[model samples]
Target: MAMAKLVVTAVLVEGRSKSEVARDYGVSRRWVITMVQRFLAEGEAGLRPRSRRPRSNSRRTAAAVEDEIVELRKRLTEQGLDAGAATIGWHLGQRHGQAPATATIWRVLTRRGFVVPQPHKRPRSSYLRFVAEQPNERWQADITHWALADGTDAEILNIVDDHSRLLVGSVARSTFRAADVVACFHQAAARHGFPAGLLTDNGAVFTGSYRGGGWVALERELVGLGIRLTHSRPYHPQTCGKVERFHQTLKKRLARQPRAATLDELQTQLDTFRAHYNTARPHRALGRGTPQQAFDTRPKAAPTAAPVTVPAHYRVRRDRLDTTGCVTLRHNSRLHHIGLGRRHAGTRVLVLVHDLHIRVLSEDGELLRELTLNPSRDYQPQPKP
Candidate 1:
């Protein structure tokens, strides 16, 4: 518009020739002449910029197909399912045997006001992701909390195969204990076969080392089954990002359904979601294939067939000395209390355990006591100093 107005002003007000104005403005003479003529005839409206869109587009998406796209977006969004352009296109192709390209679907959505522009988000290309090379190579596990209609809080344990993003297990419980974590692991293992390794955050149910130098039930069970276990660093949840993300997806689906009145009802909802997610839903990360397809596409990884010789358990736990100046450790599911001198009571200490051998260190790094625990006794008595 500014250029058009400038050319018109140069030719009309300055009395410059159209050819000279075109040459000075670096515009084609034909354009300059047309602008001057329009300005003379229409006064000012002709100088305004006009859209260059063609009168009609033969390749435009058909009205009926566009309506179907909008309907799919509404239906999927209402059901709390993914309704992105790729997903909608996949469904269209499946239903009609031919679908518009993803870009065309996006344009249709934008034209229909179904797309909201977000120019501030970080681009997906900026992320660096790590995935397991084979199915069952690593399983990521996490627990999320939800509430029932009665306002009772429940915990859901979710496990996903790192390679396929398959929801190997999802169960709801009133509260999770170390025993519950072990049970869910075995249930999923029985169905999908044992994963070569498991990755999880440093939750007490997953690991006992953080609370004290002890072995939790889940940790012991995995070790006995020849499966390796890995824990994320303290306060770092991204180490188990797969299962963490799965929680968000599951909650979105749950949010769309009627809030469950009981745990059984919630379990039913989870089962339905798992079926659709594994078999029907298209995963953008998996090239529009479902998780079940990806899980079955390649040979699965498993724990080595040879029996694994379990190494001794070793961990360091930070604690405050109790009034009795004692700390506790659990080995082979048995709890043992070790005695430090009464004088050290109320001091901060670190308890380092290597199998049955124990070393208690003060906060200043001074070794307060050291001893080998006796399996036959619950209390490890201190020696005369």
Candidate 2:
């Protein structure tokens, strides 16, 4: 617009020739003539910029198809199902025998104001993703908190298959205990078969290593079943990314439904969601195939009877608690201060380092304090009961 105004002014007001104005502005002579004609006929309004969009697109998605996409998005959202472009495209294909490409569906959603731009989100390519090669190769487990209609807090334990993105189990309770985790694992394994390995965070219910390197009930059960067990590094949830990501999806669906009044009600909702997620909803990571399809099509991996060995970085070092009742231990070139309480100051202790897991014992070999070191921070404070 500014260039057009400048060209018109130079020709009409400055008494410049059309050829001279076009030559000076580096625009074509025909463009200069068209701008002068527009300024003369419609005044300044004619000098405003016009859209470069084509007058008509013969290959554009049909209005009816676009309407169906919008309708599907709305219906799926209302039903608490995934309404992403890939899932929507799968639905369209299933219903009409043909569907627009995933990119086309995304463009239509954006044009209809259904998609929000998130430029600050990290790109998926930058992530170092690890996936299981086949179904039952590994399973990731995690617990997330939710609220009931009465404002009471509830914990939902989610177990997901690493290869197929299947929600093998989703159980809700007022609070989850080590026993509950073991029971849930058994139930999920009974249905989907045992996985070769289980991945989880350093939650106490999942592992007793945080206490004194003893296996918890779930860990013992996994060992008895010959399934390997692994815990994510402290303060690092990415190792169990699959199940952590599933928690977000589950919570989204739960948020769309009416808040449950009881644990049983919440469990019912979870059961329904797990069925739909495993059998109906298309998984974006699996080329839009449902989890059940992916799981069934692949060969299952069996549990290995390999013995658990100490981590490569495992070491025991002697140290005395400083006046602040904190003992510092360095692992991976980073120092971490473990709090053992003020009374234990000046006491001799052994700092055991197993990767990021830590345990402090008195000189007599009595366990004094144990925790997972949060490498992001220097001080590891005693967790609140």
Candidate 3:
């Protein structure tokens, strides 16, 4: 409109034809003629800036309502919950009874920094969406590196239930050894009931010192508890994404605030974080509800106790060891001196580790002793020093 008016003024004031004015000012001849007539009548007032505000603001959200929507979006985003306009509107209506329209929510969201531009290139799409039907049905485990104030790397092993997002275990360990993980698993199982399935990466700890081949002693134990052990494929961290994301949340949004003094000190912080993560922190998958909410709202379909079944080929042997913790097992006509180490005198034991050996667990399910064929090499790794 302004360009047309300028062309008309040029054509009339300079005594130029429409084509000449159009050529001079670069506007169409018809527009130049039409605007020149309008200018002749309405004068310079016809060349004023148009009103930017909509003629009718009927669709606009009220200032108070818009402010409320913005505030809610900020809060939800800070809590790591879904802050999309549609989600915010639903929440504000259903949860807070705002009953505002989606457009209002969107305007508020954009005004209050609730949206971000999509990245140019994102990771390849994932098809695997973990759905745990019941609590303790399946759990994911991983280890991450933390640091003490002294700058020493601390290996933190974490285990969390897939369904509940419960932090079953998060302990500081010097090494991510299979035996070390076994100890932590025992601690976690003692608190929460034994899981039916364990999901972990193909790290040395999960697959054992010797990789491949079904599973090591740790897998065997999980199998005994009626638990299925599955390993994420190598170079595929997304296979164990639940625990991986948990680690991300733990390090970035939560615990990077303070300096930790020691591993024990870090563990204390972990415990506090675990409580909040389970009960307070909202999960995007859980419809903006916490893990505890999902866990509690859902029914339990998992076993309360560990699976203790022996393999079909394996035969059960109930035996007793002497006061010296040595057991005499008749295998291939050889009396094997399995070291019980003065711990199991007259206890019923099951041989789970290897042939020509037995392990005794007390009435309280305590590992009373492990009678090993090679006692010297059992707990003691050969030392170079």
Candidate maximizing TM-score: 1
Report lDDT (Cα) of residue 73, candidate 3: 71
Candidate 3: which stretches are off by over 4 Å? 1-118, 121-126, 209-215, 303-385
Off by over 4 Å in 2: 1-27, 32-50, 307-385
Model 2: ten consecutive residues of lowest lDDT: 305-314
Backbone clash pairs for candidate 3 read 224-307, 225-307, 226-307, 324-342, 325-340, 325-341, 325-342
Encode model 3's per-residue lDDT on 250-284: one tens digit a residue. 77533444668777788887788778778866666
User: Tens-digit lDDT track for model 1 on 1-385?
Assistant: 8899998888788999989988988989999989888888998898887899999999888899999999999999999989899999999989999899999999999999999999998786776689999999999999999999999999999999999999999999999999999999989989899998899998889877677456677866765576767788888786787898888888888999999999999999998999999998999889999999999999999975233222456575656778998887787889888888688888866576777787876543467887888988888888975
- Measured with C-alpha atoms, the lDDT of residue 197 in candidate 3 is 78
Listed per candidate, the RMSD to the true structure in angstroms reads: 8.5, 10.7, 12.9
Query: How many residue pairs clash per model?
Result: 0, 0, 7
Instruction: Put down candidate 2 lDDT per residue, 275-346, tens digits, no spaces.
Output: 989998888889988899999998999887543333335565555689999988776788777887899999
Q: Candidate 2's error at 222, in angstroms?
A: 2.1
